[model samples]
Target: MNGTNKGGAAPGRGGGLASPRFAAVMASQALSLLGMEILQFVLPLHLLNLTGSGALYGGVIAAGFVPYTLLAPIGGVIADRTRKRGVMIAVDAVLAIAMAAYLFAAGTSAVIAATVAVLMLAFAAQALYQPCVQSAIPHLVESHEVERAVALVNQVGMLTGIGGPVAGGIAFGFLGLAPIVFISAACFAASALVVAALVHVPYEPPARTAGAVATARADLKEALAFLRSRPLMWRTIMAATLVNLFGSSFFNVCSPYIVTETLGLPNQLMGVLQGALAVGGLAGGAIVAAVPGTLGIRRVPALLLGVVAGIAAIACVLMVPLPALGTYTALVILYLPTMAVCMCMSIVATSYLQVESPGTLVGKVMALAIMLANCVTPAGQLAYGVALDIVPAWAIALVAASVTAAVAWWLARAER
Candidate 1:
C-alpha cells in the first residue's frame, strides 16, 4: 500500500516533492494546465474580437466568478466529506466534457451568452477542484515539504503558462479554435485519469451525533471560527481580495483592449504578453522552492506595495503611443515583476495556510477564506467594466493601484 509502489508518495521526513504520488499529480496537472491556459487566452480574445466592446469583455469575465464564489464553501465541504481523489477526478472529467462548449462558441450566434456559459462551467469545476488539490498537498508530503510542494505545483502551472499561451496564440491563429478545444478536452480527460490512479489521502468525516444539516452547519462554523482566531487569515484574505479587485482589469480588459484594440495588434501577439507573466511565475516558483521562508508572512504587505507600484507603471505605459510590437514588449516587461512578486506571495501564503490548519478542516477553511475574499471581486470586476466605458484604461489601472496600496497598508496595520 506504499505510495511508491502504487504511485503514492512516502510520508514523514523522507517525503518531499520527489515522491511518486506528487510526481504523478504534477504530471497530470501539467496536462490539464496546458489545455486550460490555451482556452483562457482564447476565450477572452474570442469575446473581445467578437464584440469589440471592452465593457462587454469585462462583464463576461465578471459573470463567470459568481458561480465559483458561491460554490466554494459547498465544494470545500464536499472535498472534506468525500474522498479527495473522487472529487478531483469527477470535476476534471466534468470539465473535460464542458470543453465542448467552446466548439459551439466558434460560430457567431449568441457569442456573449456562449462565452459566459463556458466561463461559468469552467469556473464551477475549478471551484470544486481547487480546494481538493490544495487540501491534498498536506497529505502528499511530509510536514516540512509543504512549501516546496506548493511551489512545485505552482511551478507546474507556470510551466504550462509559459508554453500554453504562446502555443494557444499560434494554435488559435493558424489552426483556429476547433483543434484547441479538442486538445483542452483531451488534457482534462488525461488529468482525471491521472488523479484516478493516485493513492487515496486519509480523510474521515468528523464524528457528530447531530443530524446531517446540523453536522454541516457545525463543520462550517468551526472553519469560520478558526478563521476568526487567526489575524493572518483575515489579512491574507483582504490582501488577496484587493489584488483581485484592482488587478482583474489588467487581464480581463486592459491587456486585451490595449493590445488588440488600442495598439491595433494581432491577436497572436497576446501570447507574448501573457507568456511574460508565466515566465515570472516560473522564476518565482524556483526561488520560493529554494528559499521558502525568505519572505515572512508579516511582510506580505510590502510585497503588495511592489505589486501596486508595478500596476501604476503599467498604467503609465498603457497610455504611451508606441508601435504594436513595442507596446506588447513594454507591457510584458512591466508584468514580469508584478507576476513574480504575486507568485511568490501566493506560495508563501499557501504554505502558511498549510502549516496552520489541521488536515481535517483545511479544505473548508481555505475554501471559506477564498469564498469570502471573492465576494468583492465580482463587484470590482463589474465596476471595472463600467469604468472601462467611462474612463481611459490608464486612469482605471492607476486608481485601482492606489486604492490597492492603501488597502494593503491597512491590512498590515490591522494585523500589527
Candidate 2:
C-alpha cells in the first residue's frame, strides 16, 4: 500500500516533525481539534443551563459517543481504502458547514434538538476522522519515531484543549454561544484548507474482488483473525476498557455536576478545571514524546494504580471541610496529575498497538482495539450520570477508585 513520498521521505522510514507533510497534518489537526474541543466544553454548559438535569446532560454527552463507538470500524475501512488527506479535508469542511448552519438555528425552538444533532454529527465525524490520522502516523514517521509522532498527535489536541474550554467558557460567559460557534466554524474551515493544500499521505489503491460491503466484512475479519492470535493485545484492550469505564467516564460525567451543583462553583471555574484536564494530557504527551521508551507497557499497571490513588484522593478532598474555592483548588491540583497519569497510560497502550500491528492491518486493528476500549465509555457515562443523582460525590469517587484498582490488578496479573 506504500507509495513514493512527496515533500518527505518514504513511509515508516523517514520524516520526523521536520517533514513538511507531517507538520501540515499536525497543523490541520490542531485547528480542527481546537474547534471541536471548544464546542465540547461549551455544549454541556448550554445543555445544563437549558435542562438543569445531570441525567439529561450526561445522556447528551453519552449520545455523542454512541455513534463514535459504532462508526469507528467503518472509519477504519475508509482509512485503509481511501486517501487520508482527502478524508481529513472533507470531514473538517463538513463540520464547518454544520456549525455555521447551527449558528442561525440557535434562536429557534429546535435549539436543544439541533444542539444534540450537531454534537452527534461532530462525534460521528470524529470517529471517522481519527482512524485516518492515527493510521497515517506510522506512514509519516520512521519506525523508531512512531511513539514521538503519536505523542505529538496527542499533544496537539491536548494543547488546544487547554485553551479551548477556557476560551469557550469566557466567550460563552460574555458573548454567548454565537461567537464561539463562529470561531469553531472558522477553525474547521481553516483546518480543511491546511489539509487540502499541505498534508501529503502516500496512497495505493486497495485490491477488491467483492462488493464494498463484502470487502469491508472481509477486511474486518482479517483484522479480527490477527487480533485473535495476539492474546496480549486482547488483554491490553480489556485493561484499557476497564480504565475508560471507571476512570475517564467518572470524571467526564461527574466533574460538571460536582463543580457546578455540589460545590456551587461558577461556570468560569468549570472551564478552568476542564482546561486543567487538558493540561494534564499535554504534559503526559510531552513526557512520552521526550522519553518514549521510559514508560513501557510494563509500567501501565503502575500508571493505572496511580489513577486509582488520584480518584481516592478526590474522595478525601470531598470529605474535607473546605471553602468552595479551596475545594476547587484541591480538585485542580489533584486532577491535573491524575489526568497526566491517565494520559500516559493511554499513550503507552496506543503506542504498543501501533508498534505491534503491521502497516496494512494497522487501521482495522487500531479501530477494533479502540472500539472495544471505547465501547464501554458511553455506558459508564450513563451509569455515572444516574449515579450522581443519588450518590454522594465522595462515595462515587471511592467506588470508582475501587473498580479501577481491580482493573489495575488484572492488568498487572496479565503483564506478569
Candidate 3:
C-alpha cells in the first residue's frame, strides 16, 4: 500500500516541488492557512480594540498557545500512527465547523468568549495538522530536493501572511468581522475537500502491541532518546526558544500596541505592517529555494545578527522625534530584513533535522522539537504585554535587541 496509489507515490520517486502530488498538498495547506492567517490578524486587533487592554489582548492570544503546546506532541504521535491525508482533512473540517459557529455568534454578548474559543480551536488544529505536513515532506520528494520542498511549503504560508492580513484588515475596516468569519469557514471547507480529493501520503498500520496512552508514552520516550544523541537538536531548540522569547514575542505584543494605541493608526495600516513580515518570509523562502547549497545551519547565528540590527533600528527610530506615519513606515521597512533572515535560518535548521531523522520517528521528533522551542512563547508574550503597560515600548525594544544579540553571539560560538 505504501507504494500503491492508495497512498502517495513511493518516497524519493516523485519529482521535486513540481510533482502533482506535492502540489496538491501545497494547495490544500494554502487554502486552510490563508483563512487562518486572516483570522489570526483580525481577531487580536478586534479584541484589543474592544477591550482596550494590551494585557488582556496578550493573555487571550497566549491562552490559545496552551492547547497548541500541549497538543503538538500528540499531533505528532497521531501523524505517525494515522493516515496523514485523513488527519489534514479532518482538522480542516473541524476548523470550518468551528468558524461557522462563530460566524453566527458575532456581535452577541458571547462573541468575545466565542472569539477566544474559536482561536483556541484553530491553534489546536494547527498544532495537529502541521506535523503531518512537515513529516510528509521527505516522503513526497527526492532526497536531494528536500530543502527546496520545505522552502516551497514555507512559501505557501508566507503568501497567506501577505494576502490574509491585507484582506482581513480591509474587510474588518469596511465590512466588519462577520464577512471575514464567513470567508474563513468557506476556506476551511474548501481545504478539507481539496485534501480529501488530491493529497496522499505513505501510510502503514502501526502494530498495536500496547494501549494508546502507553504507546504514546513509549513513542515520546524513544523520541527523547534520539534527540539526546544529537547535540544539534538541542542547539537548534535553544536557539529557536531564544528567538521566540526575545524576538518574536516582542513583535507580537508590541506591534499592535504601537500601531493601534500609540500611533492611533487604522486597521488597514496594521494589516500592511503585518504583511511586511510575510513579505520578508516569502522572500527568504524564495532565496532558499533558489540557492539551497549556500545557506547551512552554521549560518543561522549570522542571520540572527541581522535580526539584532533590525530590532535595534526599530528601538532607535521610536525615540527620535518623528511623525506617527514616519515611525510606522520605518517599523514596516525594518521588519523585512529581520524576518527574512529569521525565515532563512528556520528553513535551514528544519531541513537539516528532516534529513537527519529516521522516517519512522520524524513526526514525533519534529513535534517534540517544536513543543520544546515554543513552550516559553506564551510566557514571553505575557511578559511583553505587561512590560508594555509598565515601560516604554522603546525600552522594551532595546532590551529585546540586546538579548537577541547575546543569543546570536552564543549560537555563533557554539557553531564554531
Local distance difference test scores for all models: 0.78, 0.86, 0.86
Query: Residue-wise lDDT of candidate 3 within 114-150, one digit each (tens)?
Result: 8889888999999999999998887888777888888
lDDT of 2 by residue, 1-416 (tens): 01222222345565777798789889999999999998777877787867677887788888888888898899899999999988898999999999999987788888888888988999999988899988888788887777888888999989898889888887787788899999999999999999988998888887999999999999999988988898878888888888788778888889988988888777778888999999999999988888878898888889989999999999999999899889999999998999899889888888888777777878888888878888989888888888888888888899899999998898888767
lDDT at residue 106 of model 2 (Cα atoms): 83
TM-score of each: 0.92, 0.96, 0.96
- Over all chains combined, what TM-score does candidate 3 have? 0.96
**Candidate 3 clashing pairs?**
none
Query: Model 2, stretches more than 4 Å misplaced?
Result: 1-12
CA displacement after TM-score superposition, residue 41 of candidate 2 (Å): 1.2
Candidate that beats the other on lDDT, 1 or 2, i.e. the better one: 2
Model 2: pairs clashing at backbone N, Cα or C within 3 Å: none
Per-model C-alpha RMSD: 4.1, 3.1, 3.4
